[model samples]
Target: MSKIKITQVRSTIKRSKRQKATITALGLGKINRSKEVTATPQILGMVEKVKHLVRVEEL
Candidate 1:
């Protein structure tokens, strides 16, 4: 599978709990932190849920 990079770009303060949890599940909790993961449908769905809070890059 192709790999993609997920980076947290915004703060989670005052955000919904579901958004926060999705960020955590993506292995990010701090601004500028990044995680490289496989481009699986599940991961893509999680990214979609928190797209406003993260930056995704193809790798």
Candidate 2:
């Protein structure tokens, strides 16, 4: 299976509550923080939710 590297490229201060929570759920809170997660359906959904606040790379 493939994996994904999710990085917080921007802040979520003024974003929606769900978007902020999504960043935290991905193990990121501040800009430049990153986490490696499995490319599961659940993670994919979360990524989609906050796609604008993060940068993703295949791993």
Candidate 3:
């Protein structure tokens, strides 16, 4: 599997509950926080849902 860095780049205030939950699921609850995770389809889907709130980089 490949790894990717997920970094929270924006505030979650005023966003939908689903979006907030997705961010948490990706190990991000605070702006500027980051987590390195495998690039699975499930993770990719979650990232897509909150694309506007995070920054992704290949590792």
Candidate 4:
């Protein structure tokens, strides 16, 4: 599977609990932190849920 980079671009303060959890699930909790992950459907769905909180790039 292809890999992608997920970066936390914004703060989670005042955000919904679900969004915060999704960010944590994606291996991120702080601004500018990044994780490289396989482009699985489940991962993509998580990313979609927190799309506004992160930046995704194909790798």
Best by lDDT: 1
Q: For candidate 2, give the lDDT.
A: 0.93
Can you tell me which runs of candidate 3 are displaced by over 4 Å? none
lDDT of 3 by residue, 1-59 (tens): 99999999999999999999999899999999999999999999999999999999999
Can you write out model 2's per-residue Cα lDDT over 1-59, one digit (the tens) per residue? 79999999989988999898888888999999989999999999999999988999998
What do the candidate models score in CA lDDT, each in turn?
0.98, 0.93, 0.97, 0.95
Candidate 4 per-residue C-alpha lDDT over 9-59 given as tens digits, one digit per residue, 9 for 90 to 100: 999999999998889889899999999999999999999999988999998
TM, every model:
0.98, 0.95, 0.98, 0.97
Identify the runs in model 4 with alpha carbons over 4 angstroms from their true place.
none
lDDT of 4 at 22: 87
Ranking by lDDT: 1, 3, 4, 2
Superposed Cα RMSD, model 2: 0.6
Cα-based RMSD of candidate 4:
0.5
Q: Which stretches of candidate 2 lie over 4 Å from their true place?
A: none
